[model samples]
Target: MGELIAVYLTVHTPRYCTYETAFAGKLAHPDFRAVRDGLVEQGRQLAGVQPDAIVINSCHLVATFPTVVDGTPRHRGILTAQEAPELIHGVEYDFPGDYELASAIIDRGRAAGHVCTLAADVHYPLDYGTVMPLVCYLDRTQRIPVVPVSVTLANDLEECFTWGQYVVRAVRERRRRAAFVASGSVSHKLVRGPERWPSPEDQELDHRFARMLADGEYEKLWAWLPEYAETVEAEMGGRHLAMMLGAILESGRRFAAALHAYGPSSGSGNYVISLS
Candidate 1:
Protein backbone atom coordinates (compact mmCIF):
# COMPACT_ATOMS: atom_id res chain seq x y z
CA MET A 1 0.00 0.00 0.00
CA GLY A 2 1.15 3.52 -0.67
CA GLU A 3 2.05 5.61 2.34
CA LEU A 4 0.97 9.17 3.01
CA ILE A 5 4.21 10.85 3.93
CA ALA A 6 2.91 14.29 4.77
CA VAL A 7 0.04 16.78 4.62
CA TYR A 8 0.23 20.53 4.12
CA LEU A 9 -2.03 23.59 4.04
CA THR A 10 -0.85 26.56 1.97
CA VAL A 11 -2.12 29.86 0.70
CA HIS A 12 -2.49 30.59 -3.03
CA THR A 13 -2.64 34.37 -3.14
CA PRO A 14 -1.06 35.75 -6.33
CA ARG A 15 0.68 38.18 -4.03
CA TYR A 16 2.74 35.23 -2.88
CA CYS A 17 4.14 35.01 -6.38
CA THR A 18 5.06 38.70 -6.51
CA TYR A 19 5.94 39.30 -2.91
CA GLU A 20 9.17 40.98 -3.89
CA THR A 21 7.48 43.55 -6.13
CA ALA A 22 3.76 43.83 -5.36
CA PHE A 23 4.22 43.39 -1.64
CA ALA A 24 7.70 44.82 -1.40
CA GLY A 25 6.47 47.97 0.28
CA LYS A 26 4.54 45.92 2.83
CA LEU A 27 7.38 43.51 3.57
CA ALA A 28 7.66 44.91 7.06
CA HIS A 29 4.24 43.58 7.99
CA PRO A 30 4.38 40.77 10.55
CA ASP A 31 4.06 37.25 9.15
CA PHE A 32 3.82 38.46 5.55
CA ARG A 33 7.38 37.72 4.51
CA ALA A 34 7.77 35.13 7.23
CA VAL A 35 4.87 33.02 5.93
CA ARG A 36 6.18 33.17 2.38
CA ASP A 37 9.70 32.23 3.45
CA GLY A 38 8.44 29.47 5.73
CA LEU A 39 6.45 27.93 2.85
CA VAL A 40 9.61 27.83 0.76
CA GLU A 41 11.44 26.00 3.54
CA GLN A 42 8.53 23.64 4.04
CA GLY A 43 8.53 22.91 0.32
CA ARG A 44 12.19 22.05 0.49
CA GLN A 45 11.57 19.71 3.39
CA LEU A 46 8.74 18.01 1.46
CA ALA A 47 11.00 17.58 -1.56
CA GLY A 48 13.62 15.96 0.65
CA VAL A 49 11.08 13.25 1.50
CA GLN A 50 11.14 12.10 -2.13
CA PRO A 51 7.47 11.35 -2.47
CA ASP A 52 6.33 9.56 -5.61
CA ALA A 53 3.38 11.89 -6.05
CA ILE A 54 1.80 14.92 -4.48
CA VAL A 55 -2.00 14.84 -4.40
CA ILE A 56 -3.30 18.37 -4.28
CA ASN A 57 -6.82 19.71 -3.64
CA SER A 58 -6.92 23.22 -5.05
CA CYS A 59 -9.67 25.64 -4.16
CA HIS A 60 -9.46 27.26 -7.54
CA LEU A 61 -10.40 24.02 -9.31
CA VAL A 62 -14.05 24.10 -8.46
CA ALA A 63 -16.44 21.33 -9.49
CA THR A 64 -20.16 20.76 -9.29
CA PHE A 65 -19.76 17.05 -8.65
CA PRO A 66 -18.43 15.51 -5.51
CA THR A 67 -14.91 15.17 -6.88
CA VAL A 68 -12.82 15.41 -10.04
CA VAL A 69 -9.32 14.00 -10.53
CA ASP A 70 -6.95 15.22 -13.20
CA GLY A 71 -5.78 12.09 -15.03
CA THR A 72 -3.79 13.79 -17.73
CA PRO A 73 -0.45 12.07 -18.23
CA ARG A 74 1.34 15.33 -18.94
CA HIS A 75 0.66 18.93 -17.93
CA ARG A 76 2.03 22.03 -19.65
CA GLY A 77 0.70 25.51 -19.26
CA ILE A 78 1.36 29.23 -19.10
CA LEU A 79 -0.88 30.56 -16.35
CA THR A 80 -2.02 34.13 -15.99
CA ALA A 81 -4.30 34.13 -12.97
CA GLN A 82 -7.57 35.87 -13.80
CA GLU A 83 -8.03 37.08 -10.24
CA ALA A 84 -4.77 39.02 -10.20
CA PRO A 85 -3.09 38.87 -13.57
CA GLU A 86 -0.78 41.72 -12.63
CA LEU A 87 0.73 39.58 -9.88
CA ILE A 88 0.94 36.20 -11.67
CA HIS A 89 0.89 36.48 -15.42
CA GLY A 90 2.48 34.42 -18.17
CA VAL A 91 3.97 31.88 -15.75
CA GLU A 92 5.03 28.69 -17.54
CA TYR A 93 4.80 25.25 -15.95
CA ASP A 94 5.36 21.73 -17.28
CA PHE A 95 5.14 18.66 -15.07
CA PRO A 96 4.50 14.94 -15.14
CA GLY A 97 1.08 13.81 -13.99
CA ASP A 98 0.28 10.57 -12.16
CA TYR A 99 -2.46 9.20 -14.35
CA GLU A 100 -2.42 5.75 -12.80
CA LEU A 101 -2.87 7.08 -9.31
CA ALA A 102 -5.44 9.63 -10.40
CA SER A 103 -7.46 6.95 -12.09
CA ALA A 104 -7.35 4.89 -8.96
CA ILE A 105 -8.66 7.83 -6.99
CA ILE A 106 -11.52 8.23 -9.42
CA ASP A 107 -12.43 4.55 -9.34
CA ARG A 108 -12.27 4.40 -5.59
CA GLY A 109 -14.23 7.61 -5.17
CA ARG A 110 -16.95 6.34 -7.48
CA ALA A 111 -17.14 3.10 -5.55
CA ALA A 112 -17.52 5.14 -2.41
CA GLY A 113 -20.62 6.85 -3.87
CA HIS A 114 -18.85 10.05 -4.86
CA VAL A 115 -19.25 11.65 -8.26
CA CYS A 116 -15.63 11.26 -9.31
CA THR A 117 -14.31 11.41 -12.87
CA LEU A 118 -11.03 11.72 -14.74
CA ALA A 119 -10.15 14.86 -16.71
CA ALA A 120 -7.78 13.61 -19.43
CA ASP A 121 -7.78 16.46 -21.89
CA VAL A 122 -4.43 18.06 -22.66
CA HIS A 123 -6.25 21.35 -22.94
CA TYR A 124 -7.01 21.29 -19.22
CA PRO A 125 -4.86 23.91 -17.53
CA LEU A 126 -3.53 24.10 -14.04
CA ASP A 127 -5.13 26.67 -11.82
CA TYR A 128 -3.06 29.24 -9.94
CA GLY A 129 -4.04 27.65 -6.64
CA THR A 130 -2.28 24.48 -7.83
CA VAL A 131 0.61 26.09 -9.70
CA MET A 132 1.51 28.74 -7.15
CA PRO A 133 2.28 26.24 -4.41
CA LEU A 134 4.21 24.00 -6.80
CA VAL A 135 6.26 27.00 -7.86
CA CYS A 136 7.04 27.87 -4.25
CA TYR A 137 7.51 24.33 -2.91
CA LEU A 138 9.07 22.25 -5.66
CA ASP A 139 12.46 22.56 -7.27
CA ARG A 140 12.77 24.51 -10.51
CA THR A 141 12.55 21.17 -12.36
CA GLN A 142 9.52 19.86 -10.41
CA ARG A 143 10.76 16.29 -10.35
CA ILE A 144 7.73 14.85 -8.57
CA PRO A 145 4.49 14.04 -10.35
CA VAL A 146 1.18 15.54 -9.25
CA VAL A 147 -2.46 14.38 -9.08
CA PRO A 148 -4.59 17.49 -8.90
CA VAL A 149 -8.04 17.16 -7.37
CA SER A 150 -10.85 19.70 -7.43
CA VAL A 151 -13.00 21.04 -4.64
CA THR A 152 -16.75 20.60 -5.16
CA LEU A 153 -18.90 23.58 -4.40
CA ALA A 154 -22.02 21.42 -4.21
CA ASN A 155 -20.64 19.12 -1.54
CA ASP A 156 -20.93 19.89 2.13
CA LEU A 157 -18.00 19.68 4.54
CA GLU A 158 -18.93 16.11 5.58
CA GLU A 159 -19.14 14.98 1.99
CA CYS A 160 -15.72 16.48 1.32
CA PHE A 161 -14.38 14.56 4.31
CA THR A 162 -15.81 11.36 2.92
CA TRP A 163 -14.19 12.02 -0.42
CA GLY A 164 -10.91 12.54 1.38
CA GLN A 165 -11.20 9.12 2.98
CA TYR A 166 -11.58 7.58 -0.45
CA VAL A 167 -8.52 9.49 -1.63
CA VAL A 168 -6.45 8.10 1.24
CA ARG A 169 -7.56 4.59 0.38
CA ALA A 170 -6.67 5.05 -3.28
CA VAL A 171 -3.19 6.33 -2.40
CA ARG A 172 -2.48 3.48 0.01
CA GLU A 173 -3.74 0.80 -2.36
CA ARG A 174 -1.41 2.11 -5.07
CA ARG A 175 1.58 1.53 -2.76
CA ARG A 176 3.43 4.75 -3.52
CA ARG A 177 4.78 7.37 -1.18
CA ALA A 178 2.61 10.45 -1.46
CA ALA A 179 1.98 13.85 0.09
CA PHE A 180 -1.33 15.70 0.39
CA VAL A 181 -1.66 19.43 -0.05
CA ALA A 182 -4.63 21.73 0.58
CA SER A 183 -4.23 25.02 -1.28
CA GLY A 184 -6.52 27.78 -0.03
CA SER A 185 -7.02 30.39 2.66
CA VAL A 186 -9.39 30.95 5.57
CA SER A 187 -11.91 33.69 6.41
CA HIS A 188 -12.04 34.57 2.73
CA LYS A 189 -14.46 37.44 3.01
CA LEU A 190 -13.16 39.98 0.53
CA VAL A 191 -13.05 43.64 1.33
CA ARG A 192 -12.69 46.75 -0.84
CA GLY A 193 -8.91 46.72 -1.12
CA PRO A 194 -6.27 44.01 -1.58
CA GLU A 195 -4.34 45.20 1.46
CA ARG A 196 -7.34 45.21 3.76
CA TRP A 197 -7.64 42.81 6.70
CA PRO A 198 -10.66 40.82 7.79
CA SER A 199 -12.78 42.03 10.66
CA PRO A 200 -11.55 41.33 14.17
CA GLU A 201 -14.21 38.64 14.61
CA ASP A 202 -13.14 36.87 11.45
CA GLN A 203 -9.47 37.16 12.38
CA GLU A 204 -10.19 35.66 15.78
CA LEU A 205 -11.98 32.76 14.14
CA ASP A 206 -8.99 32.10 11.92
CA HIS A 207 -6.70 32.24 14.94
CA ARG A 208 -8.77 29.69 16.82
CA PHE A 209 -8.97 27.38 13.81
CA ALA A 210 -5.20 27.57 13.30
CA ARG A 211 -4.64 26.80 16.94
CA MET A 212 -6.91 23.76 16.72
CA LEU A 213 -4.95 22.37 13.79
CA ALA A 214 -1.61 23.08 15.48
CA ASP A 215 -2.76 21.42 18.69
CA GLY A 216 -3.92 18.26 16.87
CA GLU A 217 -7.47 18.80 17.97
CA TYR A 218 -8.82 17.22 14.83
CA GLU A 219 -12.09 16.13 16.35
CA LYS A 220 -12.89 19.58 17.61
CA LEU A 221 -11.87 21.19 14.36
CA TRP A 222 -14.03 18.85 12.36
CA ALA A 223 -16.98 19.50 14.61
CA TRP A 224 -16.74 23.25 14.34
CA LEU A 225 -15.85 23.46 10.65
CA PRO A 226 -19.37 23.61 9.20
CA GLU A 227 -20.52 26.48 11.35
CA TYR A 228 -17.21 28.26 11.05
CA ALA A 229 -17.20 28.05 7.28
CA GLU A 230 -20.64 29.63 7.05
CA THR A 231 -19.88 32.31 9.58
CA VAL A 232 -16.46 33.33 8.29
CA GLU A 233 -16.88 32.66 4.53
CA ALA A 234 -14.01 30.18 4.41
CA GLU A 235 -12.25 29.83 1.09
CA MET A 236 -13.76 27.15 -1.17
CA GLY A 237 -16.30 26.63 1.56
CA GLY A 238 -13.49 25.07 3.61
CA ARG A 239 -13.81 21.97 1.43
CA HIS A 240 -10.05 21.87 0.90
CA LEU A 241 -9.35 21.86 4.61
CA ALA A 242 -12.01 19.25 5.26
CA MET A 243 -10.49 16.94 2.67
CA MET A 244 -6.99 17.41 4.07
CA LEU A 245 -8.21 16.63 7.56
CA GLY A 246 -10.12 13.56 6.41
CA ALA A 247 -7.11 12.18 4.57
CA ILE A 248 -4.83 12.67 7.56
CA LEU A 249 -7.16 11.42 10.23
CA GLU A 250 -8.60 8.52 8.26
CA SER A 251 -5.15 7.17 7.48
CA GLY A 252 -5.02 5.81 11.01
CA ARG A 253 -1.56 7.31 11.45
CA ARG A 254 -0.38 9.91 13.87
CA PHE A 255 0.98 13.17 12.55
CA ALA A 256 2.64 16.12 14.23
CA ALA A 257 0.91 19.31 13.12
CA ALA A 258 2.62 22.66 13.17
CA LEU A 259 1.55 26.14 12.16
CA HIS A 260 4.39 27.51 10.10
CA ALA A 261 2.97 30.96 9.58
CA TYR A 262 -0.29 32.92 9.19
CA GLY A 263 -0.79 36.12 7.25
CA PRO A 264 -3.43 38.32 5.65
CA SER A 265 -4.29 38.60 1.95
CA SER A 266 -7.13 40.79 0.75
CA GLY A 267 -8.92 40.55 4.07
CA SER A 268 -8.53 36.78 4.12
CA GLY A 269 -6.47 34.81 6.62
CA ASN A 270 -3.80 32.82 4.87
CA TYR A 271 -2.14 30.10 6.89
CA VAL A 272 0.76 27.80 6.10
CA ILE A 273 0.94 24.58 8.06
CA SER A 274 2.61 21.19 7.92
CA LEU A 275 1.46 17.80 9.21
CA SER A 276 4.32 15.37 9.36
Candidate 2:
Protein backbone atom coordinates (compact mmCIF):
# COMPACT_ATOMS: atom_id res chain seq x y z
CA MET A 1 0.00 0.00 0.00
CA GLY A 2 1.16 3.50 -0.80
CA GLU A 3 2.00 5.68 2.18
CA LEU A 4 -0.72 8.09 3.23
CA ILE A 5 0.02 11.74 2.36
CA ALA A 6 -1.49 14.45 4.58
CA VAL A 7 -1.37 18.21 4.10
CA TYR A 8 -1.74 19.84 7.49
CA LEU A 9 -1.84 23.64 7.73
CA THR A 10 -3.51 26.78 9.14
CA VAL A 11 -5.40 29.81 7.72
CA HIS A 12 -5.86 33.40 8.82
CA THR A 13 -7.08 36.69 7.41
CA PRO A 14 -5.03 37.62 4.32
CA ARG A 15 -3.31 40.41 6.19
CA TYR A 16 -3.38 38.62 9.51
CA CYS A 17 0.19 39.63 10.30
CA THR A 18 -0.34 43.21 9.20
CA TYR A 19 -3.25 44.32 11.29
CA GLU A 20 -2.10 47.13 13.57
CA THR A 21 -4.71 49.80 13.20
CA ALA A 22 -8.42 50.32 13.57
CA PHE A 23 -10.51 47.85 11.58
CA ALA A 24 -11.13 50.33 8.76
CA GLY A 25 -7.52 51.39 8.47
CA LYS A 26 -6.25 47.82 8.57
CA LEU A 27 -8.76 46.79 5.97
CA ALA A 28 -7.56 49.54 3.61
CA HIS A 29 -4.36 47.85 2.49
CA PRO A 30 -4.10 46.69 -1.12
CA ASP A 31 -1.54 44.10 -0.09
CA PHE A 32 -4.12 42.46 2.16
CA ARG A 33 -6.37 41.90 -0.86
CA ALA A 34 -3.47 40.54 -2.92
CA VAL A 35 -2.36 38.15 -0.20
CA ARG A 36 -5.94 37.08 0.32
CA ASP A 37 -6.14 36.25 -3.36
CA GLY A 38 -2.89 34.32 -3.16
CA LEU A 39 -4.11 32.18 -0.23
CA VAL A 40 -7.27 31.17 -2.06
CA GLU A 41 -5.17 30.25 -5.10
CA GLN A 42 -3.12 27.98 -2.89
CA GLY A 43 -6.30 26.24 -1.81
CA ARG A 44 -7.35 25.78 -5.46
CA GLN A 45 -4.16 23.83 -6.04
CA LEU A 46 -4.87 21.73 -2.93
CA ALA A 47 -8.35 20.89 -4.14
CA GLY A 48 -6.89 19.79 -7.48
CA VAL A 49 -5.03 16.93 -5.81
CA GLN A 50 -8.31 14.96 -5.75
CA PRO A 51 -7.15 12.91 -2.79
CA ASP A 52 -9.32 10.69 -0.62
CA ALA A 53 -9.84 13.66 1.71
CA ILE A 54 -8.72 17.16 2.75
CA VAL A 55 -8.96 18.04 6.42
CA ILE A 56 -9.12 21.63 7.76
CA ASN A 57 -7.54 21.58 11.17
CA SER A 58 -7.63 24.79 13.20
CA CYS A 59 -8.55 26.32 16.57
CA HIS A 60 -10.82 28.96 15.06
CA LEU A 61 -13.78 26.61 14.75
CA VAL A 62 -13.54 25.35 18.30
CA ALA A 63 -16.57 25.27 20.56
CA THR A 64 -16.52 25.98 24.29
CA PHE A 65 -15.51 22.34 24.35
CA PRO A 66 -13.33 20.61 21.75
CA THR A 67 -15.31 18.71 19.12
CA VAL A 68 -14.83 16.95 15.77
CA VAL A 69 -17.66 16.92 13.20
CA ASP A 70 -17.24 13.96 10.84
CA GLY A 71 -19.51 14.93 7.98
CA THR A 72 -18.97 11.80 5.91
CA PRO A 73 -18.90 9.29 8.74
CA ARG A 74 -22.54 9.98 9.38
CA HIS A 75 -23.65 11.59 6.10
CA ARG A 76 -22.33 13.04 2.88
CA GLY A 77 -21.71 16.81 3.05
CA ILE A 78 -20.46 19.58 0.82
CA LEU A 79 -18.30 22.73 1.18
CA THR A 80 -20.68 25.06 -0.61
CA ALA A 81 -20.48 28.77 0.10
CA GLN A 82 -23.58 28.60 2.25
CA GLU A 83 -22.20 25.72 4.33
CA ALA A 84 -19.20 27.89 5.25
CA PRO A 85 -20.99 31.22 5.48
CA GLU A 86 -18.35 32.62 7.78
CA LEU A 87 -16.22 33.04 4.65
CA ILE A 88 -19.13 34.81 2.96
CA HIS A 89 -22.23 35.05 5.04
CA GLY A 90 -25.61 33.84 3.78
CA VAL A 91 -24.10 31.82 0.96
CA GLU A 92 -24.45 28.05 1.20
CA TYR A 93 -20.96 26.58 1.20
CA ASP A 94 -20.14 22.98 0.31
CA PHE A 95 -16.94 21.01 -0.28
CA PRO A 96 -16.32 17.26 -0.60
CA GLY A 97 -13.39 16.91 1.79
CA ASP A 98 -14.58 19.11 4.68
CA TYR A 99 -16.91 16.70 6.47
CA GLU A 100 -14.87 13.49 6.08
CA LEU A 101 -11.84 15.22 7.44
CA ALA A 102 -13.90 16.84 10.16
CA SER A 103 -15.09 13.45 11.36
CA ALA A 104 -11.60 11.99 11.39
CA ILE A 105 -10.24 14.97 13.28
CA ILE A 106 -13.09 14.73 15.78
CA ASP A 107 -12.33 11.08 16.46
CA ARG A 108 -8.68 11.98 16.59
CA GLY A 109 -9.34 14.91 18.91
CA ARG A 110 -11.41 12.79 21.30
CA ALA A 111 -8.55 10.34 21.56
CA ALA A 112 -6.11 13.21 21.96
CA GLY A 113 -8.21 15.24 24.49
CA HIS A 114 -11.80 15.88 23.63
CA VAL A 115 -15.51 15.03 23.69
CA CYS A 116 -17.42 15.04 20.41
CA THR A 117 -20.22 17.51 19.72
CA LEU A 118 -22.06 18.58 16.59
CA ALA A 119 -22.48 22.24 15.55
CA ALA A 120 -26.13 22.20 16.69
CA ASP A 121 -27.76 21.74 13.35
CA VAL A 122 -26.72 22.93 9.85
CA HIS A 123 -26.51 26.62 10.73
CA TYR A 124 -23.09 26.50 12.26
CA PRO A 125 -21.19 28.32 9.54
CA LEU A 126 -17.53 27.58 9.12
CA ASP A 127 -15.26 30.37 10.28
CA TYR A 128 -13.25 32.26 7.63
CA GLY A 129 -10.09 30.48 8.66
CA THR A 130 -11.67 27.51 6.93
CA VAL A 131 -14.06 29.13 4.43
CA MET A 132 -11.56 31.51 2.90
CA PRO A 133 -8.93 28.94 1.97
CA LEU A 134 -11.35 26.17 1.00
CA VAL A 135 -13.48 28.50 -1.06
CA CYS A 136 -10.49 30.18 -2.64
CA TYR A 137 -8.81 26.94 -3.67
CA LEU A 138 -11.86 24.91 -4.66
CA ASP A 139 -13.68 25.56 -7.90
CA ARG A 140 -17.33 26.40 -7.28
CA THR A 141 -18.39 23.24 -9.15
CA GLN A 142 -15.82 20.69 -7.93
CA ARG A 143 -16.99 19.51 -4.51
CA ILE A 144 -14.54 18.28 -1.85
CA PRO A 145 -15.85 16.97 1.46
CA VAL A 146 -14.35 18.76 4.50
CA VAL A 147 -13.77 17.63 8.07
CA PRO A 148 -12.99 20.26 10.72
CA VAL A 149 -11.06 19.25 13.84
CA SER A 150 -11.33 22.03 16.37
CA VAL A 151 -8.52 22.38 18.88
CA THR A 152 -9.27 22.58 22.58
CA LEU A 153 -8.68 25.45 25.00
CA ALA A 154 -6.68 23.30 27.39
CA ASN A 155 -2.92 23.84 27.45
CA ASP A 156 -2.04 20.21 28.07
CA LEU A 157 0.91 19.35 25.85
CA GLU A 158 0.46 15.64 26.36
CA GLU A 159 -3.13 15.87 25.18
CA CYS A 160 -2.11 17.77 22.08
CA PHE A 161 0.64 15.28 21.28
CA THR A 162 -1.66 12.34 21.80
CA TRP A 163 -4.21 13.96 19.52
CA GLY A 164 -1.44 14.41 16.96
CA GLN A 165 -0.78 10.71 17.08
CA TYR A 166 -4.43 9.95 16.56
CA VAL A 167 -4.64 12.27 13.57
CA VAL A 168 -1.65 10.58 11.95
CA ARG A 169 -2.89 7.07 12.69
CA ALA A 170 -6.45 7.67 11.54
CA VAL A 171 -5.32 8.87 8.13
CA ARG A 172 -2.81 6.06 7.82
CA GLU A 173 -5.41 3.39 8.63
CA ARG A 174 -7.85 4.55 6.01
CA ARG A 175 -7.96 1.93 3.25
CA ARG A 176 -8.00 4.71 0.69
CA ARG A 177 -5.26 7.31 0.26
CA ALA A 178 -5.76 10.88 1.54
CA ALA A 179 -4.07 14.26 1.84
CA PHE A 180 -4.53 16.52 4.88
CA VAL A 181 -4.22 20.27 5.17
CA ALA A 182 -3.59 22.35 8.29
CA SER A 183 -5.35 25.70 7.86
CA GLY A 184 -3.61 28.39 9.87
CA SER A 185 -1.07 31.21 9.56
CA VAL A 186 2.26 32.06 11.12
CA SER A 187 2.52 34.73 13.86
CA HIS A 188 -0.12 37.35 13.31
CA LYS A 189 0.10 40.75 15.04
CA LEU A 190 -2.47 42.48 12.93
CA VAL A 191 -4.58 42.96 16.01
CA ARG A 192 -3.54 45.76 18.32
CA GLY A 193 -1.80 45.05 21.58
CA PRO A 194 1.14 46.61 23.44
CA GLU A 195 3.38 43.84 22.07
CA ARG A 196 2.61 44.44 18.42
CA TRP A 197 5.89 45.54 16.83
CA PRO A 198 8.13 43.73 14.36
CA SER A 199 11.34 42.59 15.95
CA PRO A 200 14.64 43.31 14.15
CA GLU A 201 15.46 39.59 14.28
CA ASP A 202 12.24 38.43 12.59
CA GLN A 203 13.84 37.35 9.30
CA GLU A 204 16.57 35.34 11.00
CA LEU A 205 14.00 33.70 13.28
CA ASP A 206 11.69 33.02 10.37
CA HIS A 207 14.53 31.23 8.59
CA ARG A 208 15.21 29.05 11.62
CA PHE A 209 11.52 28.14 12.01
CA ALA A 210 11.04 27.38 8.31
CA ARG A 211 14.13 25.17 8.38
CA MET A 212 13.01 23.26 11.48
CA LEU A 213 9.66 22.51 9.89
CA ALA A 214 11.38 21.43 6.68
CA ASP A 215 13.70 19.13 8.62
CA GLY A 216 10.78 17.46 10.45
CA GLU A 217 12.33 18.06 13.84
CA TYR A 218 9.41 18.25 16.28
CA GLU A 219 11.59 18.37 19.37
CA LYS A 220 13.62 21.22 17.95
CA LEU A 221 10.45 23.01 16.93
CA TRP A 222 9.04 22.81 20.49
CA ALA A 223 12.41 23.66 22.04
CA TRP A 224 12.53 27.00 20.25
CA LEU A 225 9.16 28.24 21.55
CA PRO A 226 10.37 30.08 24.66
CA GLU A 227 13.21 31.83 22.84
CA TYR A 228 11.15 32.46 19.72
CA ALA A 229 8.40 34.19 21.69
CA GLU A 230 10.94 36.46 23.35
CA THR A 231 13.06 37.15 20.24
CA VAL A 232 10.44 37.56 17.53
CA GLU A 233 6.74 38.35 17.20
CA ALA A 234 4.92 36.40 19.90
CA GLU A 235 2.06 35.45 17.60
CA MET A 236 3.78 32.73 15.58
CA GLY A 237 1.90 29.46 15.16
CA GLY A 238 4.37 27.26 17.08
CA ARG A 239 1.92 24.99 18.88
CA HIS A 240 -0.38 24.76 15.89
CA LEU A 241 2.52 24.00 13.56
CA ALA A 242 4.05 21.55 16.00
CA MET A 243 0.93 19.46 16.48
CA MET A 244 0.24 19.32 12.74
CA LEU A 245 3.83 18.36 11.95
CA GLY A 246 3.83 15.77 14.70
CA ALA A 247 0.63 14.32 13.32
CA ILE A 248 2.10 14.00 9.83
CA LEU A 249 5.38 12.49 10.97
CA GLU A 250 3.58 10.13 13.32
CA SER A 251 2.49 8.26 10.20
CA GLY A 252 6.19 7.72 9.33
CA ARG A 253 6.24 10.02 6.31
CA ARG A 254 8.97 12.55 5.70
CA PHE A 255 8.06 16.06 4.56
CA ALA A 256 9.76 18.92 2.74
CA ALA A 257 8.53 22.49 3.15
CA ALA A 258 8.80 25.09 0.43
CA LEU A 259 9.28 28.59 1.81
CA HIS A 260 6.92 30.32 -0.54
CA ALA A 261 7.42 33.82 0.94
CA TYR A 262 9.12 35.09 4.11
CA GLY A 263 9.32 38.85 3.88
CA PRO A 264 7.73 41.54 6.05
CA SER A 265 4.88 43.01 4.10
CA SER A 266 2.99 43.52 7.36
CA GLY A 267 4.60 44.80 10.55
CA SER A 268 4.09 41.46 12.25
CA GLY A 269 5.80 38.21 11.23
CA ASN A 270 4.36 36.67 8.03
CA TYR A 271 5.23 33.70 5.82
CA VAL A 272 3.66 30.98 3.67
CA ILE A 273 4.81 27.37 4.12
CA SER A 274 3.88 24.51 1.79
CA LEU A 275 4.73 20.98 2.97
CA SER A 276 5.02 18.05 0.58
* Best candidate according to lDDT: 1
| Candidate 1 lDDT over residue span 1-276, tens digit each | 688888888878876655353224445355467667767767767867778888999999988865789988888888988888877888888888999889988898777677777988788988989987886564446778889999998888888898788778888889878899999998999875656678999989999998888888888899999999899999988999899889988887777876778777778988888887
Q: Against the hidden reference, what TM-scores do the models get?
A: 0.92, 0.71
For each candidate in the order shown, give its overall lDDT on alpha carbons.
0.82, 0.52
> Any residue pairs clashing in model 1, and if so which?
1-175, 2-172, 2-175, 2-176
RMSD of each: 2.3, 5.9
Best by TM-score: 1
lDDT of 1: 0.82
Worst 10 residues of 1 by lDDT: 19-28
